[model samples]
Target: SQTIHQWPATLVQPVGSPLSLECTVEGTSNPNLYWYRQAAGRGLQLLFYSVGIGQISSEVPQNLSASRPQDRQFILSSKKLLLSDSGFYLCAWSGSGNTIYFGEGSWLTVV
Candidate 1:
């Protein structure tokens, strides 16, 4: 395995709507999972990360939050959406080195 899975591959929401993104990694143990966002023409920006179960770190101050409900699962959620929050969201995981794997990604467009 060593694969990453994410849901709601694409989304279109009105401003002020709520959003949730889920991800899971398989075939690995205690992997470092990350949540990232990419804008129209910008690079990936780290939003949150987790080293282990119940260990989450936020890199930016925004409406986004993350959780590790299980050892292999990571979640990203927002209670209220903003136009600026629309972007390409990605879930990734890494082992003990520089190698990292990313999910198929979720694209969000706010109207």
Candidate 2:
């Protein structure tokens, strides 16, 4: 079965600092990878998706960016974090857009 892993279950960052969050999947190959951010109780907001290595699509343009270095490794990075950049970061994988499964997620707070 496919599964994802994200670290620092929770994080606190200062304004203007850099941020890097990692996500990887096991048991599957060439999965449709995605990155999402959830604000409070709101629904998931698509940030990026990758069809393959070094291939990414951004759904939003903000203080964030994403990269897919390897087939199953996805990374989210920001050079300068903003207070508004704080939120729940999630990584998901699916064979198709029909359905998806996610990682446990990382909670980030910028102060």
Candidate 3:
């Protein structure tokens, strides 16, 4: 059984602070990992994705960046936070099919 883990479950940060959100996939090898963000009531937006370690693709340009330092570990980071960066961030993975599973998600509030 493959599963994705993301944390922290919630975060409160001031504007201009740094941010780091971690996600990892268990029980799978070389799976496609993705970082998606959903605003208060908006649809999920693809921020970044990785097909392999050290290989990342950005879907949109923003204040955040993603890295896959290890095979199954994906990280999202921001050097400086912004009020517009507040949202529900979800980590997801897909393996061998169209089905993608998501984590419990992290709620970020920038004050």
Candidate 4:
């Protein structure tokens, strides 16, 4: 049984402050991990993806970064926050197919 866990169910921060969101996969090997954001009434947007540890691909240029320090661990961070960054964040993983599994997700509202 595989599972994904994302932390900080919700967050509220001021602009220019730091932010960190974490996600981890369990019971899977060499899984493809991804980070995505969804705006209100909008479709999900891919932020980052990792094929393996230390390998990250950014889908868009923004104030966020993703890192894979361990095989099952993925971290998303921002040195400074922006009001435009407010949205719903999701961490997911896929296992060689179209079936993508996601975590509980995190909501960010920057003021």
What lDDT would each prediction earn against the true structure?
Answer: 0.93, 0.92, 0.96, 0.96
What tens-digit string does per-residue lDDT give for candidate 4 at 1-111? 999999999999999999999999999999999999999988899999999999999999999999999999999999999999999999999998769999999999999
Which candidate gets the maximum TM-score versus the true structure?
A: 3
Which scores greater on lDDT, model 2 or model 4? 4
Residue 50 shift from truth in candidate 4, angstroms = 0.4
Q: What is the C-alpha RMSD of each candidate to the true structure, in Å?
A: 0.9, 1.2, 0.7, 0.8
TM-score, each model?
0.96, 0.94, 0.97, 0.97
- CA deviation > 4 Å runs, candidate 4: none
Query: On residues 6-109, what C-alpha lDDT tens digit does candidate 2 reach at each position?
Result: 87689999999999999999998998899999998777899999989999999988999999999999999999999999999999999855589889999999
lDDT of 3 by residue, 28-62 (tens): 99999999999977899999999999999999999
Once fitted onto the true fold, the runs of candidate 2 whose alpha carbons sit more than 4 angstroms away are none
Whole-model alpha-carbon lDDT for candidate 3: 0.96
- Candidate with more favorable, higher lDDT: 1 or 3: 3
Backbone collision tally, model 1: 0
Candidate 1 wrong stretches, greater than 4 Å:
none
